[model samples]
Target: MTGPGNPHGGDAGEKSAPAPKKGKRELWKLIPGFAISAFFLWRTIKSIHYDDLRSLHVVQPVWIGVMIAFLLGSYTLRIYRWWFMLRRSGAAGFGVCSRVLLTSFAANNVLPFRIGDFLRVFTYAGDLNASSSTILSTVILERLLDIFTLLAFLVALLLGAAHALPPVVVRGHELNVLHFAEPVLVLCAVGLILLLFGAPLLQRVVESVVRRLPAGARTEKLQRWALLLFDAVLKLSFAGRVLLLVSSIAIWLCEGMIFVSLSRMLAIAVLPRGPWLAVALSNLGFLIPSSPGAIGVYESFCKAAMTSQGAAPGISGIYGILVHVVVFFSVTIAGGVAFLAHRMARGAASRPLRADLADLPVEMPADLPPGISS
Candidate 1:
């Protein structure tokens, strides 16, 4: 097998050595996120005393059932929304969608760097009979919709219940939440408006930018992918867009109910609007990009929101810990079970699947959204 190109090795080009440097580089990138999580965890722990452990008692055990109910409701709505978004793509059935969605979030809970998102898009895209671009477009849209809804909830809080809540104090200074949230809210609103109304313009701009890139297989592939993002949104009718927004609102409200239920379960005297505020702030904290499951970042944000509204520091810390545990473990365990079942079923059928984008075509298909061919 020794030839001119492989004079010193057997199948030298066919089986190249793995790039250890690339693996090391990826590991190195995760160091900062872990450090950030550690720092916040330490800060959160130091603020809580041994007495905080007492707050773990469930005063009204019935609320425990309520919390679980809302948790299930939120995930159910989320799975349906994902399916609805990909309906035109001929996505899989409700059961398939649920398993994939839960497995993805479970991956996010256990793995760092939000790997679950890419996992969902790459691994299940083929099973769903949709392109990677379409799946990714829906994922990005989901995040945007969540952000918009959360911000809107925050604004509603300020308008409807700000007077009922205590001022948020940071470092002995009264903090104005609205002052900061309003600008971001405005930006998100404007972005959504533009995305929905000016999709064609966005598509054109993407084309113009793609045209400027050096002509290559990679560049052309990227062009189709970028175009597909806006194409999915553009394809939605006015009624469909409204339905999506309404559904997004329902999903977050269900999550908000979880916080409310937890507060009641523990008998923690949160303010009238405390649960909603915590929901808005804590989920928004996810934007900070901490370690898997948001770890210390989630607790810190949740505790901060509760404490600002006059909840005891010990109870606030406990509340944060309880909420994190419920969310982190439930999804991770359910997803783990679902993934194992899926694998077993596939193995029984003797079907092998590769969860990567390499098998996809470089060129857009004729069935792609109408403007993608242009």
Candidate 2:
């Protein structure tokens, strides 16, 4: 039920798997993922043109290749952005972070119940010999930054796309996407403002409160991690902040181009705002509590976006499947490779140690950079 050598031994088997009762509970949690994915996939397939699917090879291989290139570039930028943050938090090397990033993505892609997130935290903690608390804080920060960036893009898209969005009337209510999105947009906007203007004061307040507490192990640990989170935020240079936002937006934009590429290949009309909206909306699918990769959620949102842009339902459905396949395989392949290489390298390095020495615990370092303790 477990992997060969346990790096997340301290996680009480949560990393590799859950206990039977917990596992059953997690399986129950998969109901929504399965239902949503099954329903949307069924709907999508029902709309697919059998003849068009048969001739799916009509698209140019070159554009597909270009999409892959952009995907790689986008991932590179994302990893580099993470590296910047990791370094700020006292992580030492880019190599370890790179492998951890890919492995985490791969795990998330393959596993259920979002176990990959735990795997990601444990993996990073193991690689850096850092505490899970500190690494988890960084991971949380990464996701927050990512969400903020995506919300910004969505807000911008919704505002500019008011005219282009297809009409949706449900239960005799003329539903406006912009109106629905406004609340979330306002929230994100307010959060952005606070991060820009009030983070320092908040950090100071947190630091004072945490420092005044007793210095026991738990309190010390909590104090260290709390301060690390704020300090990392404070240490981000203006240029680094720009890089985070720009790289995030650029990643989504590059991904959006896949829709355009597919459209061009399929000889469909999905331009102007279709690809962008599809990209934004489809990504929002990940926020849904669905199966790994948010299968149904992504396809449904994307197909809707494409259909809104005058694309045939058949083509849009097929296009969504194609895009999902391409992205899934690409990330899995890359992540798999990185993960295996890291494991093999670690094995080789450790195998050389004397048998008695190898079993000894390697304590986490005491001298972490300021505002952090392992």
Candidate 3:
């Protein structure tokens, strides 16, 4: 994670640093992100009881190793999941997918504004010569899938466990955050279901509009892109859909192990309701926009969850920071390695910036717009 000249431990000449304007643009997008992170981070920090921070030393060393293993496993599955989506988009090969995914992950964790996401589109669009629209669609789909899965986890942990949230009394009134989450989850669940089920209808509506509109390149292209996204959304077969579900569940399981183990590592007793609730809460925090790698939002939600479970503020504070560091550094290092591997394999005669899509059978639809097939 050094400077751009050798981010992945490359030769100093591999690439120069990003230009000044580029850096500024990245920073500019992050203004809101950092502001949000700072607010939440300050809130969590103010709550910490410094005296109890000593509790961190008692965390089991063994769980630390377990947490690492789970994180690795989770990342592996994440690569596979992306590979899976790319294949559906007429791209294959796990090697390429892993490089883009890990490198993008490193970028997101290190840089600002979630710019890493565009790396997925760039790499695949260049290498596979597939529609960028399609690749971007899958990316959005992947996120929605993750969100839905996390929501499921939240719902399950809420219903299946007692003391899911610690009660708080404010001027003799009782409040628990979990109560708020329940309705939100229910509404979100309904919305997601509708989105999935309504894709075809939405697709038809867009297509109809596309047919009627007087064609201009930009407008027509945008409409077609929308059609393509809806098409991708509609096209996940039952098996592919199942795979997404299983992979999402597995990834979070790995994350939950990390969360629970790290809490143990910090020697905080999170039981009964356990780490699932903590995991759920922290992930919910991530759904909100924040600084790179969700720095403040993540810790705030985690500390909130732990404190509600009666963990000391000192324990929660240290646990949050340490866990974030573990993940942030681990993935960044792995991404660097992946970048190096990609460079080594490709060497000087790397693949073209754009390549033919001969691997998958693709046909222009007959009912498509005038310019596409004509």
Candidate 4:
């Protein structure tokens, strides 16, 4: 639970000093992501034309409100999903969970490497006096649910198409969506199979490795943490798993509606399926390491998806920027506000997070994993 790099654990008053060389190494690592972001950002900007500004003159304002509504709805569902998954962990209620969730997302927007997830788990665990590993398990499961659902969506979109979808052109190269999707689909299938069926084998493998290692505290902790995460999928009840899947689909659909509303507002002509494709591709694009908030990567993916479906390049570029702006500011502002409110409610006595790895259990929860009701 300790703030990332601190192994022995420390409190608010005592902080670990990061090694300069390690810091430099981390900074060096970020350069590639920054370069990638800059390149894609340039590509996105280059795809736009000043003449496209003329489209702004006829923009519809009503869809803006609709987009905001659906965007909020998406976040609401996300909070519910997380809360449902961790409610039994002695964590706080929906309101507290919602604030933590948004604050974490806001952190991800501004900070590199999705550090917000760590913040969410550690901070909430500290507050609840519970096991960070258990909370972490829920997070791992949430991610798997999201990945599975997104891949399922891409497959549905491909199969549901009336005709063959056009290849996406990137830097003069035409790439079929299937080419990208098929491999991902296979990977997800293999991963799901391993998770659902191969946990025992994996546990045996880990045990064998651990048996050969020197006996030590670090070794035991590492084994426990690894197994906890690996077993996350199997921890959930059958019904709880079903609910998570359904909610994930609903969450993405809400986001898709946001894109649909954006297309409507921008008055960009798109195929009936265009908005969904844009939503799927743009979000999946986040997987690529890029700048905070996925800056250039998002716009590039959205523009590509829109353009591939017959929208004008200029209009697609505009739409991409517009949608990103809406999505980014909405979460950032909301998270900022939520973080402030939480701090204010706690008063001035609140201290920096003190992560105690001792809070992590050596065994998984015996009860139904957080989401499922007994």
Candidate 5:
């Protein structure tokens, strides 16, 4: 609630001062991230032979337009998913939620560590007067649901392509089957088991264990917060579950469509089902800790996936680069515009925060921990 470093009583002496050395260290941290991004950009450029650019001239403007449309649709669906999650938690409508999502996406593209996701939570909580903790809990649940859905889709893809894939892909499928599937299945099973039986189990465990502690106001408050968390978990009801499933499916479908449209634009008639595999694999690659936008990791995975599927190295590299550029620019521009609009609206509609801070609490305790520190 009160930030970890913020001290009690809100006095100047209680506040922590910024260290000059820490600022220098923070600046130094950016060096590696920027270097990683630069290295990837160079790799991507080197992979592109001039001769291949001449060949790519055949890609039509009309197909490119279609690809853009699919990407736009994907962004829209992402907003819709976030909106649905917020609605389940009693937040604002889709319009406000979409703007927040756009700003968040913009931040994620520009900032490191996917901070935009948490930013969306902050923005919505501020705008709607909802508990940031509740909204963030929904966000976490949304992500877990998305992962489960992606795993389901990956498994389905592997099974569908079992006979059609080449030996290497088949072997990859086997590895996925043996290595990834078991853990995923076990996790899903455990989550389900917990969801169904967690309430009574937790109640009994807490009553038996926590009752032994000194009975006081803090203990009562702890119990209250635990119940609130349990209630949040319970809010994942039938309708909420259905919405998560539907939205996850819709979002991935949009993504897959974008890939297919890109392939069409490139006039690659036989996309070989590998691009879908590549999409899933590329997402996994981006999960690794790295610089903002996962520049190197994303391109590397895309190139590897395409090359492994027998695509020309040059073509695959160019395609990956183009896809990244298109998606990045599209989201960033849209998000930036939306963020500016939101900022302008807030500025025009209300006085500066410093003016309002006199009336409102300087340190507004959050229902949950602050996310990403803005």
Candidate 6:
């Protein structure tokens, strides 16, 4: 059933117009995330003593260049991974996928709980002719796969580092790798089990709860859509799941290499395998769902990871600051240029849909089924 001027007019009476006030509440709901970000940034800045800024010049330009290269490479890999995921989700066209990813990253950096994520879904929806809800569901599935990959990598890194480094040879600083291993593995296993089966369970629970709501066609349709999305997500092919997992790990590894390069460029002692751990930990911090670009959280966590690895506080702080600078500027410049080009091309391609609409036949076919309407 559809209403007058509805794209699909049907036997059902005219659909009610949407309430103008329905979206007003959304503006208010955005305040908390932004407020939290501001508070976090303020506290982070206040916590940085002037002494932490000392020796900032130790980071050389050549090292900065290397770090920048690694950062760019990481972004490239991310684009590739995103393209793969989008294609698997029936969102074809590499160019559109790349643009969506680049713009999403840019939006994430600019907007405050990374609202750019929703923008990515919207962009993909327009480009792929797919539903926003479906695209968003894929994103959720992607994140779940990412968490599993991160846990697996963390466990492996801990085990390998334990064997490679002597327990007490490096002074009283005892490397308690084993201490963290059991708990981390247990958590990873639990998370994996949940990802494997928890989604379907969650859908059933949600359906039961939604069923108790006031009965109506709209409610029924919403529940049906929710179930459909869950089923589509749960039915991801084994190969597609494996691809997501592998790509997720590869993207993180590339990012770690970038961090390690940046650390070295800053003349910080490059731990043989420490950057991998640092990257894993720092990226995990970002998953905390803080502000846009994870400004305060990223810096604080990076510094902490470096400090734990025996780096001088000042040097680590400087490394964190410089890496952020490089990444921010590089992405901003590149993405801005791409965005401008995309807009220009879109403007050139756009044509009036009314021109084609006017050519449609006015009379309906007599043989058409009674329930079928367009």
Candidate whose lDDT is highest? 1
What's model 6's overall lDDT? 0.61
Q: All models: lDDT?
A: 0.76, 0.69, 0.69, 0.75, 0.63, 0.61
lDDT of 5 at 372: 19
- In candidate 5, which residue pairs clash? none
For every model shown, the clashing-pair count is 0, 1, 1, 0, 0, 1
Q: lDDT tens string, model 1, 1-374?
A: 11122222347554255335544665787888888888877767777887778546778999889999999999999999898888877878888888989999998888755667867876677777776667877887888889889988888887765443456798999867677767877887887777767778877887888889898877877776666667678768878888888899999999999999989888888786878888888888889867888888888878877887788876787788788898889889999999889989878663443323223222233233432424
lDDT of 3 by residue, 99-121 (tens): 77888888778765454665555
Please rank every candidate by lDDT, starting with the best. 1, 4, 3, 2, 5, 6
Which structure among the candidates has the greatest TM-score? 1
What are the per-residue Cα lDDT tens digits for candidate 2 across 29-92?
6787889788877877888877867755645667767776777877777678677776765775
Per-residue lDDT of candidate 4, residues 92-203 (tens digit): 7888788888988998898766777767766567664456666777777778777777787776787676333687799999887677777777888676656556656766
Per-residue CA lDDT of model 6 for 5-27, tens digit only, reads: 23344443433433223234445
lDDT of 5 by residue, 1-374 (tens): 22223323456544445435544655676787778767766776677789877777546557777777778887888877767656656778877877777777777788754657656555447775566766665566556656665666566666665433334356445433435554765676566446434645765676667688898767765565555445555666666656656777788777766766776678753446757766665666665666777776677667666676667778777777777777778888988887677768778775542343223222323333533121
- Assess every candidate by TM-score: 0.83, 0.78, 0.75, 0.80, 0.74, 0.67
Better of 2 and 5 by TM-score: 2
RMSD in angstroms between candidate 5 and the native structure over all alpha carbons = 6.4
Lowest summed lDDT over 10 consecutive residues: which window, candidate 5? Answer: 356-365
lDDT value, residue 303 of candidate 4: 87
RMSD of each: 6.1, 6.4, 8.2, 5.9, 6.4, 9.7
Query: Alpha-carbon error at 329 in model 2, in Å?
Result: 1.1
Q: Which ten residues in a row have the lowest lDDT in candidate 1?
A: 1-10
TM value for model 3:
0.75
